[model samples]
Target chain A: MTANDYEIREYLPGDEESIVRCFNDVFTDGDDRFVGRDVESWRWSFTDNPAGWRVYVAVCDGRVVAQCAAQPLRMIVEGAEATFAQGVDSMTHPAHRRGLKRPGLFVNTANAFFDRYGGADRDVVHFGLPIEQAFKMGTTFLKYEVVRTQTVLGLAPVVPPDTWPAEVERLGAFDEQVRWLYDRCSGAFGASAIRDATFLEWRFSRPGATYVRLGVRDEQGILRGLAVYRRTHLVVDDVGCVCEWLVPPEEPEVAELLERGLRRLAHEDGATGLALVVPDWSPWFAWMQERGWRVHPSVYTMCSRHWVRRLTPLWLRNHWWYTLADTDLV
Target chain B: MNGRNEPQQESASAHGYALRSYESGDEAAVLETFNRVFAAIDPTFEPRDLRTWRWLFEGNPSGRRLWLAVTPEGRIVAQCAGIAQRMLIDGEPTFVSQSIDSMADPTFTQGLKRPGAFVRTCLGYWDAYSGSGPDRDAFVWGWPVETAWRIGKSQLKYEVVRTQGLLFATERTFAAGPAPGIDVAEVASFDEDVRELFDRVAPTSRCIAVRDAPQLTWRFLERPGFTYRIATARRAGRLVGLAVFRDGSFEGVPCGALCEWLIDPDVPEAGHALAHWAFACTLEAGRDELVVVLPDSRPWWMLMQSIGFRVRPTKYFPVARYFSKRHHPRWLWDHWYYTLADTDLV
Candidate 1:
């Protein structure tokens, strides 16, 4: 069919089956990572927020040959109100594959639909094409760098925690203190939420995972700092993992607290060393550096697509990883 | 360049119209309203980054559309857009569609004074187009909690779907000491005896099989990100254990990770051999730390601690669903092991 023979139009009321078939045909590979929802979830996107949705279809010889749709972005990151638009279930019927003129026709029609109903200038469009197709389209590939960090604790030859301050051992008693530190620090990275008591219990109190909560208290027994570490079972082997170590950002004795906690883990647990993961930009990095703890590099990439420049600062955008000891997820 | 200028005035007649195409003169006004709405929601967002503005005004054929809700004074209050051929979702038989970059002029929200109205308008656009029946099976991705909460559960149901894990590598160690039970020993290479040991253990283990030289090279040695070390353990001059390690990031920490540690389960000493060899290799490589991604249910935690590996909680979201069923196929996933240098390989 010639370009003139086809009309590009908004999706009408009766186009459901045609669209579904088109979707099935286009997504031939059974990979359903994102669109794996049942029909109910598919319908929910429409019924929930209809006004924010738009679809366009191309018709030729009384049959719909191609279609496209977009919706607003829901995640509000940083300070930008961003919209994410995806090109959905777009396809050309098999019979029309031989027709060379359809692509331009369909493109023009879909663009028109976007202009009329969807505000293009105000939305960010995110689309994926196969590596070959992306190369064919002259799209630029953006690079994201991943960073890793490792922590090493120096073990005292013979000193263990029992010989240290009583407050160091008492730090393991309160779970809330650990949560407070995680929320204040890890929350900034959009890491796992630690507000729920159940989540905290599941993370800290679970079997197999080792880490004892340690706290540094004032003379009044008020909790001022907290750290979590556990020595591997002597029978299991002798390494110790520092699950968490946090001092209030305002705490003046943060260094002392860290030292006290580390010495206790090393001396009491009979550990060879201690390791933890901290964000690259975290104060913990400087803290570890000042204490003369040996640091090593790790490998892992953290990447993100931003609608607006929000949490990704130029410096923090570099590589950073949490040590297995520092994170809640194994 | 299809540019046209028009005053920012909305006609009363245009208030409740269902769906209409954009007129030539509506471009700048639509863009202006969008910037205003976005600014209200996030002041830090630069107005120019919105690709919709450029696509609509600049006339790109990559399938972009902009629809608006016109006020009585001809002002655009709410708007939505559809871009063609964008993202792909995991399992759905549809190209991904996003319902984003929307803003309801707070003046309109306050004048109407009903939060529900803005939601209703947003829902109206989504329902009219994104629904399954007709022209497209587009799925919407990335709806944050605030948007989902505002629309109400009756209208929008939120699911905590899994995506890929974002790992960072850093240069600090968090383990308190050397893990217990791990015999720290050094080995030279994966010779024939070691290969036989690895092959014998492959059939019974859950680890990915690396029987042949090509498979071994491709899966372990060929990757460009990290330096690899091969170690083997022997008892009675017969190979009984093997550990393959690489330098990589765990979370963001610089460390070595035991990507593969296999011991003949039937041979009790094999475990010790493997652990000792691996640790010695890590130390020999001059890595101050190491991490292994273990299954949530694996007994490796004990093994890790025994050999000087500390437990650090890392976050990773690996989402998968079966194409034919509602439940995910559990077998497809591997408990990943990470180290400081490995992060760069991927």
Candidate 2:
């Protein structure tokens, strides 16, 4: 009930099961609309991830009450691979969600995470899609800055243009050709997730996943653009979600290919339309809106704690190349 | 707008540096020296390539005026530039220029020393160009860094108008759209309606940039690196007010930027309707928050506060050099309806 009632510390080995219960209790209430992930998926995300995870949990009377975590990732900073972390899975137990006017479980867990991972050696920057509550706590207590807000746009179901590039094709998995496309377009951004073979394979080609990979080739058959998407019913009833796209603004034809591919996939899936979250500064927002996409504002917010402010210019948030795949949600 | 202050004559003849107007061939040298000095002093500077330089210096609608200070050997050491801007004072279109991209070779001397190359070049240019008369800039203003602010204040006698506050508010704080019985429309082009809207709104605020179709086209549409959305409020088929905004992100968060807003002072509904339209557009764009920088005394500050904008901790200083007696320095903060877009940053 008071300041001395709880203590915050790193997540111990035995805390996984409690963390699962905590996640379900905080995020799910047996709601039919939302499916709560089990301990297996939690383990796969927090423990089995190749880049490793840094997690912090708050304990009161020796029971886990709140948690905050960061999933390690390799980010491209000035053309060099640098260590980064995506802040995610922040939750405070419902019973302990008190002191609405004062610091409590949320602040303590966030502070613990910041103390552990908010260092240059640990993370170049810790970024995540925070909710309203998390955003407040992060800014008020943990020195987090709102990087930008992500908006969800709904794409209307429409027939593909008759001139849909004939070069557009679907790939079973990511290949060197896809990597070349990513590398060629990567320079369009000053900072972003490192989409090398390892990261791309782990992201889009994982087992037990249903991601559709689309690509376009130039006359010589060199990969020019790529997109990875799947069907989702989160914001829109049933829509194709292009979570990641690899095309530069200079390459208008490449963007057209990716758009055509997503539309074709959505049409075949019998989905009403396509919905994707994009940062406001992304050129793709205007591109999609110009093509008659309806924008529906979502509640997602992105915040960051800079380990070294100068490592990357904060203005990278204004970049056009950032995609939803850069977040850990993908 | 040129600050109507008595011109302080300065001559580079006293110093070893020779001052001259920018010539066609001087572009490459001036640009190189600019990049070399700025890259060392400011980290945020993106090294200017030929294309960007040409666009900023040559493609500017109000042509650029650059004065350079060079050594006897013709090595460009210092440069001062006045980037011309078209603004409306009261109701008439007027030309103003921002003194920007000022730099001197650090290898020379530090601060405003007696034999000042930087001060002489900048001040000398101002002595020649600074005036409120018809031919000269209406008034000159700029947002200078702390060091430059001190130099301008102590050495050049520039008056500090107000320190700008960057404010933010969530979409929930604002109403959905225009006020009841007031109509709002998204303007696709700055046409006759925009000119009429400007005519109606110019008298409401003390100072404003005339939002005629041509000026609006050049400021918002023709400007590179940004995409702007223009909206207007109308009553009985007549334009009453207008707002300009764009979807932007702070860091990476979705946010909206209020660039310009104008309303007819006589018609109360116009201001309310235009503010509502801007807030609604930002909310509809899915921006969580909206940001604008203005002096706290402006009328919009109170109106926005009513709708839930709170001043953030950070502040930017806005200094003005008034060249016209018609525009009082003391009344600048309250009378003008300035927005973030009025500054060079937008």
Candidate 3:
């Protein structure tokens, strides 16, 4: 009808159904890359998030027309634990796409979300890998900064490791040992997601099909590195999809051992190649290239809003340790 | 007019901050201050590890001269690094220092704003390290983000050498005609052939990095984490031009990065051959876009523009300051050949 016909509000209990519809209509009902979503998936993404989820919606005549959500996450910023929010699943009804003007439904919902949860006391920092349209709107109107452009790294012909350097084993789930190793590695980074046992178990150990957990241990059986990956298909026929691979930045030997083991595992899984996503400034990026990985350009941009410059900056992509699983869409 | 300020020597201020040359044990404090300021500027800023720090500062072929601002208690509150590289300037390979890792503690900024403590620290370092003579770094230049650019241009008297933009291929297929008498092939390493090609090209090209075998090996080959593809163009079994590229992305779009291209300035045919090969290789890889960061003066920019690449809104301000009066302002932009790799941020 008109711009004034819609009202922006926080998500209530019964808003899930309308939110799911909007998500599907905006993401799936078009030529976008995302797959179709259902009510259950939506609930799992929003309600079941480990750090909790805060959502704002635009309701036009009692029907959700636009939605913006932030999933809270504990991050290690400069060796301190901080709250960072990953802005996810923003969508507007196709009927209202470009139909409304100045402070439109999309912007209204975003403004509400920012007003509610986008404060230093609340989330501290908010970031997302949004499409071009959202990126333009966020930077031009919402005061979001262009962080770093992301790219997909593909290594084809993942040659099997000739010799394993360390003890490699498949793990049932994350353990305290994993947390200890993660803590040691996480400190070297400027900004990274909290990969404690709780975060790992909650993230990878989802109910249906869980990720394949692999660990590399040293001579004294101390955990050196961990990798979470699964088999998937990309441009190549068979690809080993790496979700999250963590190794201490200072421990180059352990990192090399872990990479070799991961490559061996991928080859054993009948994968012709391996694929993963990394920020351009990732510490691991240079290593990936040194090992002959091919970096493919992606169609995604990491946009961010820094509510507190002291704790976090808009350019956190270089410090972020993100995998496909970090995204709710995965 | 933002005029240049001559270098001056200053000691530790009674105002709580002291100035000194960098010492061995000061790296940790310097890195801490660096991360604090840089992370606040761009959260994605990579925290420099000891190895990388050593590689950048300690392993510079010419040598290092780092200046820092420390507290009375000896904790480094600010750092300014001048990493040197050899570049062809006025037909001579001269040392040009890229001013990098410059940062001041946020708490100190209130008292250390422009023309204040930070500016004095920079001038102090410049006075001691930079000069026009054979013994000194000829000039100091850097690609500063907008905020730093303004400070340099407004207060520090840095000249804008060129304004660079991100250009993307507008069409899926790049339009080009085949070049006769030029052969292009992908090569595994840089050899004397490439070095000879560089010598043939460097004298005529402005502000071009001197790409000898050692520099080439260090820049592209010995790099631990990235793979670079090199395309060589030859005539009668002699190297005339070369193109260095890598597969990268911009805003999630596949980008063919034309990192560096050196062709014999005498042979215009080499540009067409190398450009054609670069476009064809990118297209063959199924890239969504081919991109390169170049100044408007480069002959290759004309070649890129001819083949559907259009300038986008993204801009990088290239600024520089000459230490010697003998330097001409126009030499910075005239006939210069640069790519993304030339920038320290990469």
Candidate 2 residue runs with Cα over 4 Å from true position: A1-7, A29-32, A60-62, A98-102, A152-154, A157-159, A162-166, A205-209, A218-222, A233-235, A248-250, A276-297, A311-313, A318-321, A328-330, B1-346
How accurate locally is residue B176 in candidate 1, as Cα lDDT from 0 to 100?
32
lDDT of 3 by residue, A1-330 (tens): 576788889999999998888887887775545566777777766777777888998888788888888878887777767787878788899888764677777887788888999776778788887655676576556766545444566777788887654476777767788778877876657877877777777777544544678887877878888887777644444678778778877777766776777798888788778887655455676567556565543445566788886533324644666766565433
Candidate 3 structure quality by residue, lDDT tens digits, B1-346: 0112233445666656777777788888887777778888896676767766776777655457688788867777667777767777767756777788777677876755456666767876787667775446677888787677656755665664544456556344366545798888888888877778888877766567677676676667766456788888888888888788777765456778777778788776876777777777677777767777776655665556555565442445566777765543335555556676666543
* Tens digits of lDDT, candidate 2, B1-346: 1343333443346566678766678788878888898898878777877765666667666556577787666677788787676666665656667778888888765654664777777776776665665446666677787678767755665554543445566755554345665678887777777777666656766676555675567678767667899887777777777778888864345788778777666666676677666677677888778876655655666555555564432325566677776653344654666776566666
TM-score of each: 0.33, 0.52, 0.54
Candidate 1 chain B least-lDDT 10 residues: B320-329
Interface root mean square deviation per prediction = 12.6, 14.1, 12.2
Docking outcome class, model 3: incorrect
Measured on C-alpha atoms, candidate 2 has an lDDT of 0.68
- Candidate 3 Cα outliers beyond 4 Å, as residue runs: A32-34, A98-100, A162-166, A205-210, A218-222, A233-238, A277-283, A311-325, A328-330, B1-142, B149-346
Best of the two (1, 3) by DockQ: 1
Fnat of candidate 2: 0.00
Q: What does candidate 3 score on TM?
A: 0.54
lDDT of residue B97 for candidate 1:
32
Tens digit per residue, CA lDDT, model 2, A83-193: 778877887888898923366678767876887777767688887776555655665567665454344666675675655456778766566776676677777666777
Best by DockQ: 1
